[model samples]
Target: MKIFSNPNISKVMKIYEKSKKHTSEGVKETDYSKDKLELSNNAKELQIALKAYKNLPEIREEKVKEIKDRIQQGSYNVAGKEIAEKILQGVQIDKKI
Candidate 1:
């Protein structure tokens, strides 16, 4: 049997050959380098500042001692209006959330 004698078979064979050639031509050899990270001067300074900030004490002991002394002297007074305002502000923030 002569398969090429059939016009449809010949057309399909030509398409298969062309597809093989196109696919072979499309083959690419790629070379990849390892990814790198480079920090700017500002970034380096920020990292150092962050490290120092993290090393700092969370609470101010000197301020706490001064406040304690004032409270002992019966002079550490907070206004009622200020306390009410803070409470109201907290309530408004809670409502927003």
Candidate 2:
């Protein structure tokens, strides 16, 4: 039941002792008195835009009602070519990722 006799345990103990010695000798203390953060012009603009977007409604009810009316009037059409092109674009984007 002697664990130190194992080669792996001996190697681990040697590494731990080396790390302990390295850490104990002349380590300087870090200062945590003051913290500062400054945002760039572009970052500030982005934050403002994000805040405006968050204030907007999640769903545009007017647009949804208009589309619903178009469908009821039998005028709402989906182009196959456009759908195919979008599918191809999505596949290409997925491959890039």
Candidate 3:
């Protein structure tokens, strides 16, 4: 069965085709060659900091080796107070969030 053979469907299809033709004729070519982007001061600072961080070593092998050596010699000392302070700081940050 042909749906467009119905009077209502045929009328709607004719209107849709006419609208598409009119819209296509009315569209003008757009030029994007003059586009410009300006970053805020904070964004510029973040870009600079990101670049510096990218240039840094991903892992501090020297520091890691020093800690490993200290641990092997039974001299690696971790202060309980420092650990407690860090935990408390994390909790405070979570609460703020």
TM-score of each: 0.47, 0.54, 0.52
- Worst ten in a row by lDDT for model 2: 24-33
- Most accurate candidate by lDDT: 1
Candidate 1 wrongly placed segments (more than 4 Å): 1-28, 74-97
Q: After superposition, how far is residue 34 of candidate 2 from its true place, in Å?
A: 2.7
What lDDT does the true structure give each of the candidates? 0.94, 0.93, 0.93
Q: Is candidate 2 or candidate 3 better by TM-score?
A: 2
Which scores higher on lDDT, 1 or 3? Answer: 1
RMSD of each: 5.6, 9.2, 5.7
Q: Write down the lDDT that model 1 would get.
A: 0.94
Scored against the true structure, residue 3 in model 3 reaches a CA lDDT of 92
User: Candidate 2 lDDT, tens digit per residue, 30-56?
Assistant: 445788899999999999999999999
Model 3 compared with the native: what TM-score?
A: 0.52
- Residue-level lDDT of model 3, residues 27-75, one tens digit each, is 7554447879999999999999999999999999999999999999999
